[model samples]
Target: MRIEDKITTAFVLASGPFTDGSLWDAVSGRLGAAGAEVHAVTFSADPESHAGEVLRLIDSAAAPQVVLVGHDYGLHPLLAAARQRTGRVARIVHLDTAPPQDGDAPLALLPDPATQALLRDRPQALVPAPAPGEWARFGSTAGLTPEDLERLSALSEPCPGAVLTRPLRLTGALAAVPSSGILCTASGASIAGVQQLVSSGMPQFQALAEPSVGFFELATGHWPMLSCPEELTAALLLAAAGGGRRLTPAVTRPFHERPFVLDAAEAPRVRTGLVDLHLPAAEGPRPAVLLVHGGPLPRGLTPTPRDWPLYLGYARLLAGRGLVGAVLDHRLHGLSDYPTASEDLAEAVGLLRADPRVDPDRIALWFFSGAGLLLSPYLAAPAPWLRCVAATYPVLAPLPGWAGVDPAFDPAAALPMAGALPVVLTRAGLESPEIAATVAGFLDAADGCGAAVELVDAPHCRHGFDCSEPTEEARGAVRQAMEAVCAHLSGRVPIRD
Candidate 1:
């Protein structure tokens, strides 16, 4: 193997959406001046490509060593090329690109149930753009200048509906090289959507046993090359030098330190980890409630303090109800597996019930938003010891226009099972307009099943509100709801004034 300084030649993979190599002109030039040869490969305009195109680019690369960099959806193909010719590849970097999802759908437009229900019935109310000023809210954090944003807005290639919906298959290549994730928090795309993009890569990363991967969360949105070239370059150089891992600082003291394990998983799997319990309380048979974090994609199974606003408070509330609540971080959200998240929830609940300290009949289930859709199917299948369910602002249906490849769940399908179990469905009306109709529809079809529904008028509330600091109105509603649930489950009605 020939060495070119301490660095190898750089090969850029510009694959995804309606983009091409043209986007990397500025960044590539910078690398070229840094004594590295830069080669850019394009599968085709937009995301669709001929497999031969990527192979040709690899064959044309300079011999000895090369660093393969892929951005956005382009990472998939670049990964493929590297597999065919191993030695030719020195390192692979996924810049703001997600690996692959369960479905093949463009990130820009994938359907969720709420989006679908509204669009299908009232397409007229659908605005082409919502709050154009939303971009400005982030100010410079978006990573693009007014001019760059304009250029992208003008030349941006639209992703085909097919590419966005179809899930990429990378089970084979991911088994090969360990890949690093260069998540562009500063540019490229907003975190709201990019979180999912970053998460999609996790499956392959875990499969490769490459959990040692590094991440650079630059404070930028999509299009880092054009918007924040210098920061992006610095990140690239650091990554090439293998200095991209986020580690806890040495100056930290025990009192000043809260353990943030970069790799906290126990022996079984490096990716799996447990968050240390923070709040100290008397060890007793508290209600064992599991906290499942909700996001567009999984972040892993470890629950941080940040998740408290969405789940911990609710767990505390359950504990206040004479239940020892043990919150288990669902896989993929905080640090668990994508498919295994639901399974872990079941396992965690089982652990709670079997703990001799906890009453097996008191075990319950809770799912919110995205997690709701994921777990609802499991609830339908039946699990012993799951006494009741509380799903708030549930994502019961798929988005209409953004249906990604195969829809794993349909809210309509799970609606029927609600009748057979003791369930309490509540939604903060301000969060989702579709909730009223969804709950009403479910209640109408109860068919003598033991379930109840409540729609609360809580402003600026969405899913996970009860788990966080709720407004006075939301708090009141939540208190009432919890009381009602306990009363129903215990088969005793509280005296009403």
Candidate 2:
């Protein structure tokens, strides 16, 4: 092959103990056929040091630009290596894998609930390989021959339990490197909604949603390397060539015809509070909606705009409908407790009301998931300017893990305070019991108080339906919920489809 026609050196990092790197042979072979030098790195028992080993291999080759490909658990080490040698890495490819954040563990990223439970209960030494039936659950075996299945099962090994439970420590270097994702659409479908991953307040999904990270989709199962190597290889080539499109289509509506203007400003006197404002182009003093995203897992992590793609999209949707949309980043879970969050929100409300572009009396509150906790107190004697509250799968009850920390965190307790303010509650039918129970109790209180409350059910959705999977049903639910919110704030009866 001519020098320029040759592809760059590619390193294929196979996922942990579920199977040997043999599945990657087809992909590697194809790359070699294309005149690319390919090297496949299998995981060692010590995942903690795997990244170092990969670096050593790259240094030995002295390749100027290396394409780092990670599948599933392999992404952990790949990310670590990329962070250390960002300049040498050409592109980071995540193949049917969840992107790792600064402090994430393999078990935490597992899509299968049962597997997570099993690993949680098992010994924290070396985790044994899954049984044959269990292995089959990872991906579809539709195209694999009997020999392929048997070979894969036999090649599987035990992974270190530490790798599954321990948090992956990473610097922000990977963000600077070009990254792409090859989503196994079938596997993604089997898991909870993708929007839920974001709405549930996971930092990893936030990283994946970066505009810099491009994505490609495959119709195969989780083990795309084994099920659809050709398609996966094609996507890798496109990604390596910097030509892949986003896996999730961009939200062009509302913003397409009437483009919205985005502006940023920090809250007055509050050092940590930053607000992103989206305004319609043809706006005067329009009714405004304050978008409050859910807090992080009660562990005290600060929330960034990356964590609120759904809300950001909604802000644009509101702008498309001629309303000013404001998204506020309140104090993080650990930095500020309930009191601080409420205070920050109040400050944000005041700022919006005072803005000349907003109609103070027509302002609305849109709370997402855990943010509902912050909304509870406001419900108890809402201000005249607070026209209505629209909550999407809010946590009305205290999280079990945080129950001991905040004794006064009951969302139901503050329900009686929602005197006459109209409330539009969007419930995810597939939400967990804790959230479902909170919604039930809150509704009962709202009914007794005779508050104007409207319940919109997203039967096939999960918690954070607004940001959950981008299935047709999920997207439809989000649109319907947002429409309902817009109507409620406008004093019109929400027309449900």
Candidate 3:
């Protein structure tokens, strides 16, 4: 790729934790060949100060402009230096990891929360470098060959404890620096995922959509220099020209703006702080259905699920058929919000049961999308008042980034405790392969349990088929599952189609 304007660049490479400038040997060689002045620096070994060496390198650079590249813990030092040298930095490139905020602790940004918690309790002054089995704990080592892993294990240094523990501090002005994020696709983040996060209105992820920012996906692992040095060098070249993928600033329309597959006349609804109650037409103490929407949904969506046709339509349909439809917002705002989300769901259930219009003894819980993990506990300890459980296109287990999540959320593991309880599951035949595997595992687990499992198939549909597909197959599947759930709540055998 031709450099725009052909301006000279001072390439400052900050290698990630546990390794020093040597980590950038291959990358620097390639960059130097391209006629760029490259200087790679090592982080401090001292526990109290980490990036002073990086600052010194930046201060001594003679080039007209600088492009800083950081990988893993290397980002910490690069970011720290960039804060002071904001004017000189032409563009900043983030490799694999998400960029940290002004006050974020690098340790907290580990691949998953569980690892973060474990490491916090056993803090080390100098964290050791990657070993064969230990590499995965830090990040994905997807493309590293056996020899590469050996070199990594042998050459990597110990990371200073202060680098991970200390909160990153910086002036807000750094946002103006043009930036590019190089996604190690094997590590689970991609440009498409970034767009989704941006659309969800998560302020932290929203920055990736800025006009000053762009992205590139490397079909490698967290350690790109070791896995594909040439490709990483190529990406860096393009990143210098601000030539990678730019995220669309526009918010993605929910479900491609698809209309609901099934709808019923709107019912009179009672709005509370956390929930909306759609009162059934049939009046007194009617059986109620509590719909639990799925996510890691960010807090700032303009037309949240409650306003979306999916939840609204489902609620009204339930109400028109003589069931009190209760749609509530839980606190599943981000990945770690699962614990709080469960609490909010429990409180919502209590609130629903306490309502005078709903039958306290007859209520069904329906889980959807990412909310499927919330189904475990109810499956584990079924209450007499909890009549039936239904899930649609559910995430039965932890998704990729959250694989280290608590096992208590495993629906398959909890099925044995369900005993004689009835379970209704509507599966999309065309569900994403990863999620489908989980649903399949849950079904396999159910086979040995006493729980009566009824699988409803939406053949030729997707994960959110109700909203995205809207075909007769989706409609029939939805209606079938709802009838089964409502029947169980009404203390009658559900007739299957």
Taken over the whole model, the C-alpha lDDT of each candidate is: 0.50, 0.66, 0.78
Best by TM-score: 3
Q: What's the number of clashes in each of the models?
A: 55, 8, 2
1 versus 3: better TM-score goes to: 3
Candidate 2 displacement at residue 315 in angstroms: 19
List where candidate 2 sits over 4 angstroms from the true fold: 1-4, 121-123, 139-147, 189-212, 246-424, 427-497
Query: What does the lDDT read for residue 293 in candidate 3?
Result: 89
| Candidate 2: worst-modelled 10 consecutive residues by lDDT | 254-263
Considering lDDT, where higher is better, how would the candidates rank from best to worst?
A: 3, 2, 1
For 1-497, candidate 1 gives per-residue lDDT tens digits of 22224666556556444456776777777777666777666455333453456666777777455666777556666665677766666667777655543332233232233433343355333222212233332122265666775655454454444443333444354445545666664433332333332322222223322344556766666567777777777677666666565422222221112322121122111112432122213354433444454444423323343344334455545445544445556544321133456576656666666665555665556666556556556546645545567666665543211223124454445656654556666666655344445544555655445444444445566444553333666677666656655554442222121
RMSD value for candidate 2: 11.6
- TM-score of every model versus the real structure: 0.49, 0.55, 0.78
Candidate 1 error regions (>4 Å): 1-5, 45-50, 101-141, 186-212, 246-365, 368-370, 373-388, 391-486, 490-497
Per-residue lDDT for 291 in model 2? 84
Ranking of predictions according to TM-score: 3, 2, 1
Better of 2 and 3 by lDDT: 3
